[model samples]
Target: MTGTLVLAGTPIGDPSDAPPRLAAELTAADIVAAEDTRRLRRLTQALGVAPGGRVVSYFEGNEAARTPELAEALAGGARVVLVTDAGMPSVSDPGYRLVAAAVQHGVRVTAVPGPSAVLTALAVSGLPVDRFCFEGFLPRKPGERRGRLREAAEERRTLVYFEAPHRLEATLTAMAEVFGAEREAAVCRELTKTYEQVRRGPLAELAEWAAEGVRGEITVVVRGAEPPAAGEADAAELARRVAEREAAGQARKEAIAEVARGAGVPKREAFDAVVAAKNAGPRG
Candidate 1:
């Protein structure tokens, strides 16, 4: 009979946050796969529970080569447990490859709930949580990062992102440039840790604060763009937005329709606006 594969969540910061089920699984699993063997040892030491079976390293460097081996163990009736250095496995961490291999081999898969920095940061960000997206991390390269931010400029859902401490200032600066200086945002630092802090304000303000140097694990939450005030969107503004969309590779008709919907104006009005703008000579 095929065995089960358990993906367990570890504490993001505080070791005390480790769930009871985590310790139970650690002691019961027949094969434990950890992102970092030494860190896993530290976690088990803190929990005061030693694994009853073999432990193996599974991380970015060896995941590709090790997943199949772990999957075979699962297929052979071994209760294999997967855990990362922090939070849930497979969340911008190692575990996806092994999970995929297990699924392909008909092995049952499950999970143990635990703390998450993403949700923890979002809850305290002072931004809308009704609808939000977790953008794990931005591109490290400046050009790629700016392009990604530009693509999400008009996103209506609150945006969440994981970033390194050293890059926080640059990332915030890019966000300020692309998402608007006055866009509301929150910077969550070292969540669930002793020095945990949440800084809430406009993008430009956060950028300035980060510029002066910030530390610890960082998660940034930015408020979605608000629709223009009613009657405040004139034909020229509508035409300009549509043109911007068109320049970004959207069809002219679709861009006009999008602008119309965004501004709550009729499509005919938007079309007329574009035509008028075109005939009124080049905009200054």
Candidate 2:
């Protein structure tokens, strides 16, 4: 009979936050696959459980290759437990491959609930959370990052992102450029920890603050665009925005692309907004 596969959650910040079930699983599993062996040791120490199972590393670099081995163990009736450095396994972490493989091999899969940064940040962010998208991380390259930000600028639903402290400034700057400097956003730092802080303001303002240097893990939440007036957009207003970005030295094509992406409108619609403005003559 195949044994069960458990995806256990670890504390995102404080160790005391670990759930009871997490402790139970750690002490009972036949094998514990951890994203980082060192961190797993720390967790075990924190929980004071002295992890009963044989601990093994299973991070992003080795997840794919090591999954089959783990799956085979599960099939052999090993109570396999998967844990990441923080939060639950397979969440922007490893374990997905092993879990999928286990399921395919007729092994049972379960979980031990615990803390989560994504939900915590969303709750603290001043932005809307009724509907939101969890975009784990943006591209590192400037152009690609900008393009991605622009694509979500006009998103009606709130947006969340994980960003490295070192790149927070550039990320916020690009967001401001794509989503409008005036767009509302919040930067959540060191969440759930003693120094936890959530700074809320316009994207441009956040960008300025970030340039001063930021540290610790970060979660950025951006407000979606306001509903168009009368539930319909103002064509003239849209036209003005397009022209303004263009006047700021952005190429017509590039400006339109950026505006379109941010506005969540099609490229053709943005192009037409500009065309309508140009055809309307000077607005003395």
Judged by TM-score, which candidate is best? 2
Give each model a TM-score: 0.87, 0.88
Cα lDDT tens digits, model 1, 153-247, are 66788999999999999999888876778999999998888998999999989999998899998889999878787676898888887787666
lDDT of each: 0.89, 0.85
- Backbone clashes per model, in order? 0, 1
Assess candidate 2 and give its lDDT: 0.85
Model 1, position 89: C-alpha lDDT score: 96
Error of 2 at 93 (Å): 1.4
Best by lDDT: 1
Model 1 error, position 256 (Å): 8.0
The C-alpha local distance difference test score for the whole of candidate 1 amounts to 0.89
Clash count for candidate 2 is 1
